[model samples]
Target: MQATLMIYDGTAAPDSEIPRTGGVPLAPEGFIWPLCGDCCGGPMQFFAHLPVEYGVLSVFLCQNNPGSCESWDATAGANRVFLFPPAGLVAVAVPESGVTLLPAVSAIKTQVVTLEPETGDDDELPPDAYDLARSGWEREPGEWFGKQREVLGSLGGSPSYLEDDRLPGCPSCSGTTEFAAHLEEGIDRQTAMNLGGQLGYVFVCRPCSEGAFLTD
Candidate 1:
């Protein structure tokens, strides 16, 4: 299998039309910033701005009260993912209260990575190919532990180690959603969107123009 890895490429303007994390989200006219519906009921923090083949995915999660918000659940109101038209998107107006945006805008660049599933004993389950590939991303040979910060996430690939029952159903159509991307926290913990130390998953229902987010 193969995956398109999103690599950290430094800072960018908050409203630039580029694939990135921690930037002001761009949305179509009349789009409002999403509020957390699980706990605290405050505004959700903007996480990523990803441009895909069909549209732009604007993701958000609650940081106002992290663990208590159940941000890892696909059906939880604490997190959200929106798919908007590729054009006519403008920087959304930030709300005056609560956590609304990430502290830094980290730009992204893509690199295609080839992944091969590990072969193990018949009784021993192999590690996820995507997870294995992600963990092994290195800038140079034998420098295994130093370059993990450069791996922002991946563009297209199967969910890493996610169970079948956890696949999210679209709220609009009540149909299974397709895997869109995988998200890592970021280069710096202080500036990264909190995921409770879990990898984030993004799913979309193109026909209905809806998206879902979860973590594992």
Candidate 2:
């Protein structure tokens, strides 16, 4: 029997000029660490380095004392997102004190099983660009994922409307939340946050600085 190659889930070590996930964030030369406001007094975890047609988007998450830190609130100092030009790249300076970063980051490497799954063999559609890119990583993990890197915006396709029963309430205000960001696994396995084969969804309560993450 052939051994299956499974997806990877953890912070990645990236080479220069290549955008990656789970490694040190690329920031301005004089960039200062983002301090949390939820009384945790710590630096956020570097989650992703997204390079788009215009600029790069850096994402961070704060889960220090998740029980009381209110990291879910976008306004509670739980997470931060930064956008800037790639020309101004610099490694973030880690602070001597406070929570500097998360111990681990989610990563994934997908193996192609079937394009649309073998559903009764009625009709066959070739795999789309997103699906092929994800599978292509198995051939050349070092190659840059052009458009796939930006799939987080619309999840490479339309997002399903999640029902209220499946959604989570805001941790801070307990109000209904709205979809904020689609957290897809990054260009490589190290930056991929596996959600049981589903894309990750982020919802936020802007007024309370609270947010929620779940698989859709």
Can you write out model 2's per-residue Cα lDDT over 1-216, one digit (the tens) per residue? 111112443335542344445656777788877766677777765665555444565666664554566544445566665656768688776777655544444343333222333244547653343344344433544765433453333321322445557666675667876654455554455344333345655565556643455555
Query: 102-129 in candidate 1: lDDT tens per residue?
Result: 9899999988878777788899866675
TM-score of 1: 0.93
Error of 1 at 180 (Å): 0.5
lDDT of 2: 0.52
Local distance difference test scores for all models: 0.86, 0.52
TM-score of each: 0.93, 0.50
Model 1, position 91, has a per-residue lDDT of 90
Q: Choose the strongest candidate by TM-score.
A: 1
